[model samples]
Target: MRLHFLGANKQVTGSRYRLEAAGLNILIDCGMFQERPFLKRNWNDPPFPPESIDFLLLTHAHLDHVGLVPRLVSQGFNKPIITVEPSVDLAEIVMLDAARIQEEDAQYKAKRHQKEGRRPKHTASPLYTVNDAKKALPLFRGVKFREPVQLNDQVTVTFREAGHILGSAFLEIAVKQNNATRRIVFSGDLGQWSTPLINDPTPLDTADCVVMESTYGDRSHKDAGTIEEQLANIITDTTQRGGNVVIPTFAVERAQELIYYMGKLIESQRIPTLPVYLDSPMAINVTELFHRYCRYLNEESRCNFEQRQTPDLKFPSLRLARTAKESIAINNIKGTNIILSSSGMCTGGRIKHHLRRDITNPNATILFVGYQAQGTLGRQIVNGDPEVRIHGRHWPVKAKIAQIFGMSAHGDRDDLLHWLTAAKQPPKQLFLTHGEEDAATALAATIKEKLGLKVTVPDYEQTIDLT
Candidate 1:
């Protein structure tokens, strides 16, 4: 078998992997590149011919894992896309929202360039359109978790809960070649154990080879127990100063998790009851889906919902801003309130508007609860940039910046080690991807020292033979 590391090798975005074995080709992911330095890859043609692949095995719905499906379809990848059931619904929402953002951004940049009498290095066309996303939707085929499905006569795959987000999963794949069967496991964005809404990652006892993520390989999470306390303090401090608290959030698991904690704080009166505005329309929609798929949530979350006698996500001050006008009106609200918006890395979205309005106010606070990829606005702010450009203008960064470290959905170093140690026997080979160079290197050393296993950190577009 030959494996190709097409992306997410020494960086944190654009995750794609191709496998060729038994005269068949399969692509594991076709994500868009989100980091500023690599964003051009989203517009570039696929390194491999899209039509040459026989199938796609999607692990989850995060944009970095599945964002480029529409572009793949536009480029002639006409094969079945397989994933867990909930991911199908969530991915559709994510794709459509991405397409809309692309179109809007393209138009905005074009007008800005025309006004400035200068042009971008490349044509300012959207990577893919909404129609392209529509075309890609029909190819999705959902399967239940833990059920083995035959992909062809030579290969079978089973999905297991990853605990990263709703319907996120890792894959257990078996390939039969030369009358010998080889087992390969792909750990797709494994989630932290004891997270509120999702189940813990499924443990794998064996494999011939393993491909895993190392998003947080260099460090362990901060104490999870202190997340609520930190949040309460920040909110209390910001509100007491008569300023807004703006949080740039991921539309999926992170946004809901924030609401869950904020609800608890309000109920306990640990923080004053202030209006909480969920400003991203996509997040609002995803929150509703969270309700529809409550069965997939963990037992603790279920019990909390039962005890609340209402939806677990609902709080008295919560407001869902579904329309553009409603979103705009949030800026005019009087006194101190909490505004949660998306494009978590501050790449794009309503969060930018909230940041523009509040970032320069010394009385306000900016709270980050997720990873910020390099070259992103969030990273710049977190790194203490005094000023940042947003919406074609620069703004001062005077707001107090804070991060709740334990709220990340991705598991940290110790969690990754725990997951790996669950294997009854070490695999013949282990390859780590989906992290920056420093992070992947740090993890490789730890695995070799602690587990005494051979580990390879593949480079982008590099190919290796799986013996």
Candidate 2:
């Protein structure tokens, strides 16, 4: 058996892994590269031939994990991609959204190319179109949790609750090769425990080989209880002087999580019932999905699920901004509104407009609810950048920009350690992926020192033989 580390090895963006065992070829995740330079590389041609792989098993619908499917299919990969039901549903939104951005970005780059009197550095073709994304949709085979299905003669796969987002999972694979039976685990973006809507990550009894993620390996999250308090304090301080709150959140989990917390803050009388505009139409779609799949929610989250539909379940101030005109309306809106927008990392989206408008106000607050990848605007703001460029214009950062650490969907260092403690026995070797160099290296050291286990952080596109 051979395991190939294709992408997202030491870096946080693209996530693709290949496995060859018992004459079966499979990929764990076929994600896309993101952020500057990394995202720019997406047009360089296929990293590896997508047609050669047998199947893709996605953990969730995050673009970084499932964004490349359309491109893969467009390049003649005619294989069924399998995931849980919610992931399949959410992928519809995520990939289509990503496709639109890719289209716009390519057009922008091509126009600049024309100005330079040169053919575009990149082909004007997008990674895939919305139609392409939809074409790939029917290929999805949604499996229920813990149900093991044979992918081919070589392997059987099971999904474990990752607790990160709705329908997120860690895959467990059992392989039969060369008259030997082996079981391995892929920790697909482990989620923190006690998160609002999802159950805790399922514990593993043991594995022979393990692939883990270390997104927050160097740090521990703040106490979860303080999230609301910090949020309330930021809101009160910012809005007391009549400033708006701009939250750059992921349209999927992070956006909904903010809504949950904001709902709490409002219901608990922690903050005044200011208008909370969900500026992304895609995010509004995801909220309806949550309502459709209410069974996936935690006990508390489900309690809010209407057994009987009540018009009051929808908040009057909870405005859904679907069209471009509505999004632009937010720019001129005034007085103590909390507008949660997307591209959580502030890379691109309507949030950039909000940031440009609100960041110049001394009393406005820019709140971050998730991990911002390096080279993104949200990270720069968190790092105290005094000025930032938005849609080709410079915006001064006079707003009170702040972040709450505990709101991350990914499990922190402590949570990873706690998850490992239940392993009963450590694997022969652990490979850490899905993190920046510093975080992955730090996690590798901690896993060895604290857990007395062997671990290595693999480089991108490196391959290892499991003979």
Model 1 has an lDDT value of 0.90
Looking at model 2, report the run of 10 residues with the lowest lDDT sum. Answer: 306-315
On residues 1-467, what C-alpha lDDT tens digit does candidate 2 reach at each position?
78999778778888888888777788888787776658765665565677888888998888888988887888778888999889999999899888887677668768867777887654466767888887888889999989998987768999988999999999988998778778778888999999877789998767888899999999888655578888998888877889888899899988788887787788888888889999998899888888888788787767668554542225656888999899998888778888988888887777877888888989888888888888877888999998888765688889887788898889999898888778878788689999999999998888888778878899877889763
Candidate of highest TM-score: 1
Regions of model 1 farther than 4 Å from truth: 120-123, 303-309
Sequence-dependent TM-score of model 2: 0.95
What local lDDT does model 2 show for residue 161? Answer: 89
Please state every model's RMSD to the true fold in angstroms.
1.4, 2.1
Query: Which run of 10 residues does model 1 get worst, by summed lDDT?
Result: 301-310
lDDT of 1 by residue, 1-467 (tens): 98999888889888899988777798997787899999888888988999999989999999999999999999999999999988999999999999998888888888989899987646477888999999999999999998999988999989999889999998888999888889888898988998888899988767889999999999889565588899999999998899999999999989999998898999999999999999888998998888777777888876766677578898889999988899999988889989999999999888988999999999999999999989999999999999999988999899999988888889999988888889888899999999899999999999999989999999989998987
Candidate 1, 457: how far from true, in Å? 0.7
